[model samples]
Target: MKYLMPFLGLVALLACRGKNVEGKNMGKEIVEIKKENTSQGVDTLSQEPRLKTFKGLADTTFVRLADFSDGFAFDLRYATENNFLKAKVYDCAECYTRVKTAKALIAANKDFLDKGVKIKFYDCYRPNSVQYKMWEIVPNPQYVANPDKGSIHNKGGAVDITLVDMQGNELDMGTDFDYFGKRAYHDNTDLPEEILANRKLLKETMESHGFWSIRTEWWHYNLSAASNDKVANFKWECND
Candidate 1:
C-alpha cells in the first residue's frame, strides 16, 4: 500500500479520507494504515515487516529477498560450515537475487504455497569473490564454476533451493544440497516414488517460472534469461 500525502486540505479531504483522488493514489485508500493491520501487503513504515514493493527498483538491481516478503525460508549453507565446501565464506546469512530473478522466485513460491509448500533457499546470488573461494576448495570445474568466467550465481540469477511444507519440514528430494553423485542427478529416477514426486514438483514449478535446473544438481536452478548477464561482486551490508 502507498503512503499517500494528504494533497487536499483537511476540510476538502474530510469526507474522502479513505479515498484516492485522480492525481493522487493508485486506487488504494489514502489514509493512515496501522502496520499491524496489514496482514497481506507491503508496509514500508512498519516495525513489523510487511511485504515490500519493487516499484522503483531496476530489474538488474540486487535486493534482499527478506525485504520483499516473509513467505519464504532460508538455510544458507555457505554462510555456515555446512555446505560441501565445509567452509564458511559469507559475511552473513542472507538471501539476495537480481530483481528479475527475485520476481520470478516470488511468483513461483506463490504457486508452491498453493500446493501447501513454499520455497526454501539454500543459496542465492553468490558473489564472484565467493566463487573464487569455492573454486579454491574444489578446483574441479565440473563441481565448482571457474571464478574467471564466473557462474550464473555470480550474475545474481542462480539459486539453490528446495521445497518445505508450511510447517518448515523439507520435502525429501533424494539427496541433500550439493551432493556430488549420480544419486543427485535429476535423471536418477530409480529412487523411491516419493522422492521423484518431490523432484518433479520442484523442477516443473521452477521451469514454469523461467528457471532451468542443471542435470547434475536437482537443487540448482538458473534464470533462463539471465545467463548472459554480466557477473558482479555486489556484496550486501550486514546488520550489526
Candidate 2:
C-alpha cells in the first residue's frame, strides 16, 4: 500500500509538469505570432493619423472691464452702428496690455482721464470669427486679412481706438471703423488739423509703448511681439 501511494504521487507530479510545458508552448506561439505580425507592419490596432488643430485658440486671458469695475460702460450701440462687432463686448479683462497700457498712459499723462481725453476702444481682443466677418465684408487690398489666414486683432496684438474731449465727445476720425475708403489713410490731408493731431498723438503714444499704426487706419495700433504666425480664436470675457 505504501509503494502504491508513492507511485500515485509521482504520476500526479508528471501530469502537472506536462500541462505546464503545454501552456508554455502555447504562450510561446502567441508571442511569435505577435512578433511576426509586427515585423510585417500589420499593426492589429489600426489608428488614424492625428488631425491638425489650432492650439491655444480660446485663450481668454485678456480682460473685460466689468470684471474689474462696476463702472465699466461700453458703447455697444455705437460699436454696432460703426460695424465694429464686439466678440466680448465690455473690455479686454485678461489683456495685460489693455489694462497696463491704459494705466501707464494715465500715469504718464495725468490729464488723459481728467481732461476728457477719454480712451474709447473701438475694438479689442477680437476672436477669429469676427475677423473672418471683416474679411467677408471686404477682402484683399484690405489689410484686415481673414482670421483663417491671420489677423493682428485676433492675436490680441492690435487695438482700434479713439479719444474724446472732457465733455465726452467722440473725436472726428476721417472715417469710421471698417470704412473702405481713402479717408481712413494716415496721410489723408483732407482731414482737419485737430483730427490729424488727435490721430498723431494716439499713434505716437501707442508707438512709445511698442505699438505700430497701420497706414490705412489712423486708429489701429499693432502691438509688438504679437504672433503673426499663430491665429487665436480666443474670446475675451466681457466681465471676466
Candidate 3:
C-alpha cells in the first residue's frame, strides 16, 4: 500500500501540470509573460502552482492577487498608519480582490512590466466593516465613502495603486496617495510633464484592462464588471 501511494502521488503531480497558457506581449496571459525591460533588457517568468490556483475559482470569488502572480508590488497603506485615516484598521497587509478584478490587475501589471514598471498597490478589497471604521475617522462624503452605502472597495472591485519602476522606486504622481485636494484630481493639469506622463501611463494601461478611474483620485480604479458585486465582510486572518 505504501508503494502504491507513492506511485499515485507521482501520477497526480504529473497530471496537475503541463497546461501552459501561452502568453503574448499585449497582456493576455497571466504568469507566462516573460517581461523584458524595454530599455535595460531584464526579464522574468515562472510556471508555479500559484499561477494556476485561479483555474476553478468563480469570477466573483475574492482572491489574494499575489497568489496568481509575483509580477506586482504592494504598500497597503491602511495596514499601517501612513494612510489619511492615520490609523491601522487592518490587522495585516494583504491585497485581495474579486477574481474578475484580479485578472484585470494581472493583465494591467503585464503591460506595466513590459514598460519597465509595475503597479504598487496601496489598498484592495476592503471589508465593509473597515469602511465603517474609515467613515468614523472621516464622515465626510468628499473623502471617505459612507459605510452605510458601501464603496467599491467593499465590493472587491476597487484598487488604490501607483506605478513603481523596476528599481522599486515610485513614480512622481504630483501627490501621495489618499491626498485630498485639487492636485490629486484626474483633471488637474497644472502639474509637470513628467508627473502627467507617469499618471497617463498608469491610467491608460489600467483603462485598457477594463478598469475605470474616479475623477477625484488618480490612484483609485474600479473594475467595471465588479460594480454590482455584493459588499464583502470577509476579514483576513493574520498568520503568526
Candidate 4:
C-alpha cells in the first residue's frame, strides 16, 4: 500500500493525526525520525545486502556522486588521498540517502545550476566512530549533544554541503567545513546578505526534496524518509 508520510522541511516538524472508524481527528502524534532505523534491515531498493565494513568511502553505481551537470564526482578529500575523511578516519558511506534524491534536486532546479550554483559536499557518509569524534570536539549541549548519542551522519542520513561555482570554485559560506562557531547556524544574522542568500538558496532547494538542515550548521542536511523506515537503523559496511 502507498503510505502517506508527513513532509518535514529543513527545520519545521510536521504533526500527523489519523482518523479511526469514528471519523474523528486523532490526537497529535509526534513521529520520531531516527537517523539509523530501518525495517527488515534491507537497502532501500535492491535490498542488496547492506554494507557494514565502515571502511574508507568508495562510490559504487548505487552510491552515485553527482554534480550540477549530473556528472559523477568523487569526494574531494578522497580524490586528493585525504585518508582521515575516508572510512577508517571517517567511514560513513553505506547509509547514504540514495543518489536518486540528488538527481531529483538537480532536476528540480535546473536553472540554478545553469546559473553556476553547483552543489559542493563537505562531508557525506561518515562512520559512527567519526561521529563520536565530532561530538568530542564540540560536546556542547546546543551543538554536538553527546558522543554516545551519535548523529545522522553516522547513519549516512545526513550530508554536510555547500555551493560551488561553475568553474568548481567554492563559494564563501562565511565559514569553512567543520567551522565551530556561531556563524554556522541558519539563524545567525551577523553574516552578510550574500552569505545569507547563498545559504537560503541552498536550504530552500534541499528542503524542497524533503531534506532537513541542522540549526547549528547551514551545510548539514538530514534526509527524512530517505529509507522505508523513518530512521537509519540499518547497519552498512563497504562492499569491497
Cα lDDT of model 4 by residue, 1-240, tens digit: 133343344124322222242234222221112212245453443554333331343322124333223532234442232433323343343224445444444453464576666676666655555556555654575655354655655455567677777777777888876566798888898989998888888888888777888788887787674433222333345455
Error of 1 at 168 (Å): 0.4
Give the Å shift of residue 87 in candidate 4: 12
TM-score for each predicted model, relative to the true structure: 0.81, 0.56, 0.79, 0.54
lDDT of 1 by residue, 6-94 (tens): 54455576657655454366434444344335654666555664688999999999999988988999999999999889999999999
**For model 4, how many clashes?**
20
Query: What number of clashing residue pairs does each candidate have, in the order they appear?
Result: 0, 12, 0, 20
- Rank the models by TM-score, top first: 1, 3, 2, 4
TM-score of 2: 0.56
Identify the runs in model 2 with alpha carbons over 4 angstroms from their true place: 1-60, 65-73, 76-81, 84-111, 141-143, 227-229, 236-240
Please provide, for model 3 over 1-240, each residue's C-alpha lDDT reduced to its tens digit, 9 standing for 90 to 100.
979999999887776663332224335543334433423444443333535567888999988888888888999999999988889999999999999999999998989999999999999999999999999888999998888889999999999999999999999999999998999999999999999999999999999999999998999999999998898898877887
lDDT of 2 by residue, 1-240 (tens): 989999999999999999999999999999999889989977666844443222342332454433333221244322353454333332333432344333333342343454456666666656677667666655664556756667766666666677766666777876766576688888787878977878877677667666788777886777665644356676644453
Looking at model 4, report the run of 10 residues with the lowest lDDT sum. 26-35
Estimate the overall C-alpha local distance difference test score of candidate 3.
Answer: 0.89
CA deviation > 4 Å runs, candidate 1: 1-47
List lDDT for all candidates, in order.
0.91, 0.60, 0.89, 0.55
